[model samples]
Target: MLTFFSLVAATLCVSASDSTVELTTFNAGVLAGVPLWRERMPFLLSELPNSTADVLCLQEFWLETDQLAVVNATSDAFPYHVRLETHPSATPPCDATPLQAGLVCVQTRCPSNDSVDQILCALLEENCRSELRAMGQRCLNCLVLGSPNTGLLNDPLSCAVDTGVSYSTTNGLLLLSKIPLSNTVADGYNIATGEIDIYARGYLSAEVENLGTVVCTHLPTPNADRLDAPYFGPVEFNSIEEQQNAYIQQLMNRYSSKSPLFLMGDFNHGPAIGDTVAAEFPQVYQNVLDQGFVSPAETRVGLCTSCLDNSLKSTGSANVFIDHVYVQSQHASNVVDAKRLYEAVLPIGVPLSDHYGISVTYGIPVAEDPIEEWKTAFTAWKDAFREWQKNEEEC
Candidate 1:
């Protein structure tokens, strides 16, 4: 409540040696067609730009209109934005893939926890429970992951929600920037061609005027493998172990040759950046850090980006730091300031999103010279002018 209104758009100038850029990553938890967006999104968009973050990385912003609404709201401050346009990609023929068993989504209420998610504290009071036993999950997941069974008779795969609305990945990733973005790239993790996830996800990358490359992504959750495994051929235990990390490594290898990089968004797992490795995907976290990346949140112990307090968490959601900001580059420096946006829910206000956002300012060394370079150029010009004058006198 206090944190929500305290959002002030500002950047700190620590020193002249290194340049700084402030960034914020939040999972808006907004579906393209959902109405809750009306209640919460405007507040988020209006307050976010005030943070004056140089870049905003958002996940779960599914649908074209969703991105468009963000653009419309913050275009004055952040004119540059990026997302995977062609994903949840074309759905594979239902006849082509094996039958994946689990429900595309377990239907449940989405209004967020009044106590647990948007405000379901009362719902969890035991006496207030209704469908608590039969169903206990986020309703938003069901709506976003599945739809009416609109496939051919006897075609269970055809009933897949991903095959239906997948011109784009439902992963709903986007990046907006106040700085000019170049060398921009957007890609999906198809493992192989012609495969798609019901909740299609990938990364969006852009060069921030050569200071460094910033990547925004929403990696598939560990459970997501159940849905995606059937689509891709032989895969690792989970998408995070292989396809996702592999993709990150690919980008790191390519970018290291040109510029440093920053990765931000919902990784769907705690980043492995400390002495005690994360139990969830310990290797993946270490592997990424081994490539020379550091997370700001790691230094601050007891921090929870997605805890039971967040209104948008799924039922049975564990308290963890699934969303993270990781930096890899000689140019990138220590965290200047870090704050959690919309951390507390209000009595009357609905939560902004299920995952509380994190705003971090990190230093990225710029290549440009200081005042001395310009002074040297001026002195050289003066000397040349004097020599020309002498030559004219001799002539």
Candidate 2:
């Protein structure tokens, strides 16, 4: 009896120790023109030393120097792991460089398993090659069709050539952890707008031994303009609404099976306003919400304020909430506390990235059934929406 009790206690202790969450903020796209590389990267990383997040997902991360500098700086503190996805626009030609051969590293502290890292790296490289090929194919098709707007084909390909085929890598999602990642899948979603191609984004699912699944994604920003119009209806991409919806639909469809999911990324839209994608696409948000997912920041602080400064402001709008962290409802119940981390107005003279970062701490509850919770939440939300529709029609 004593032996069994001791084992149980030990297991509990280990679980408690592993159940910590930490998130940090780094000014990813800050550096310019090499030389002072080391100095440039660390400055941004230093922002998160206090939080010491278990997983660090940075945006605007330069593929060349910034990624390496981050690995060096954080090596001593978090000896666990690190992974990076550079911007698609920055990638060089396939023949010019090894696929994903840039400085982006997936640093981890698991037992020395060359096969594992090799496989993961190979997967990353293959995905990059596939994406580039797809982009190139699209460009070539556009050129052959003789559309005057060869801008898409010319600009991205040119950028790829100039930046070494690895520049502006879009899916810059990283997974850092002390736990071992048992399995991973990079699911790509095709985002379209009224049959016109907008972009493709990917969702990365990493299974951590006993911790279940963690999904990382970098959703498309509202930058892909289908036309000269400034905004689509009240939102930026109304014509592409169906495409965006399809993408989200695909995401939900693929991951719904993975109950107790934890999703983190730059959603590029917020729940604060009655405008924007989250607002315009409430049904999509509702679908996720129905599927038992909850936005940690939204639940904790209601809505996050604009994280952008004037320099990062491409659009003139003052109200914007672009970044997000959402967890399954069952996962949210385990969550003890959650909040937007970098709310401090930039120090008098210091320049950070245009967007602030968010951090949330979750406490896995003792008795939570993820699957059951998801079904209930989703059904309730769907029913409510149906009733709302009925009221609107009658009115």
Candidate 3:
């Protein structure tokens, strides 16, 4: 008992020291048909590898092919990656005509018995399909031609289906770590998500060696009316936002530990203080702040995360902040420095994404023995809980 108490004392006495990891979060705009995506995506695709980030959290990585492209490109720098593959169920067949329109043609149309294969082959053409297939692109996942079984093109009777998500783009939350990661957990919100529920917006958590647990997520937009953008009373949207924030807190409790707990992603809301547009979703960031998560961007002046409107094509004349990063203050982690990466390509000055990327370097204290350190942390946590309980009773 004395030894255990001593260990607890050691844990409590642990001080913040120098240990840093650079984390970057960016919303890489969807792959849907848009002129801005056409112009900027290529640049982003090339530049991400060169960017300096120990860990990268990306949102709006629409297609499986695009996900693969990122994984393959950064195989050297970020060998470890977790994608929250959060897409709506395909119980109903998929309609992919919209995606088909912009595809590069390889050969003249060919006749095939397979309804799905025929549409995919006609859309992709022979050469282009074959090439994209070689790159592991499949019909249902993107514009490439691969297998008919998973492509939603197999049914011989019909070719019609809904196009909201013609193919599976998933929830668009992806995490890439230079260090090895394990015990990944991901899911969409349990509450009703309304119109954009099909997107399956959710959080992804992974345990990184020495870094404790890191969570990457993209919450659903606060507006219940995604299509019309009608301004309903705060009660409708705020309630949903609060529920989502509670869910996020539950995740942090489930995944976080004695080491640093870092949360990075597009919360669809800005920092607590600035920007009128992001102010609309106050409950989102406020909940995180209430939980003792610290953000460096909150302190800086004139901080804006979003450069473009929701459409992802046009630029915004007014400043709008949304993306955010939160680090747990209870842990033995300290921020070395934090900054935002604004990717503005020269000549046209077109930003690589609709949202600017935020990165933070965190410093963690090292202990001599890993096992003892964990035990000490566990004891400290228990003691704190008991102390809180005692205080509650006194109150």
Write model 1 residue lDDT over 95-150, tens digit each, in one string: 21222312222113333322122112212222323332222221222324332222
**How high is the lDDT of residue 151 in model 3?**
34
RMSD list, candidates in order: 13.3, 18.5, 13.9
- The C-alpha lDDT values of all candidates are 0.57, 0.46, 0.59
Weakest 10 consecutive residues of candidate 2 by summed lDDT: 142-151
Global local distance difference test of model 3: 0.59
Question: Residue by residue across 291-370, what tens digits does model 3's lDDT show?
Answer: 77767766643366765433354533445567777788674246777787865653446667777888887776665576
Model number with the top lDDT: 3
The deviation in Å at residue 336 for candidate 2 is 1.2
Provide TM-scores for the models.
0.64, 0.57, 0.62
Model 2 TM-score, all chains together: 0.57
Off by over 4 Å in 2: 1-19, 23-40, 48-50, 62-64, 80-170, 190-200, 224-240, 273-283, 308-311, 345-351, 365-395
Best by TM-score: 1
Q: Number of clashes in every candidate structure?
A: 23, 26, 2
Clashing pairs in 3: 19-363, 116-153
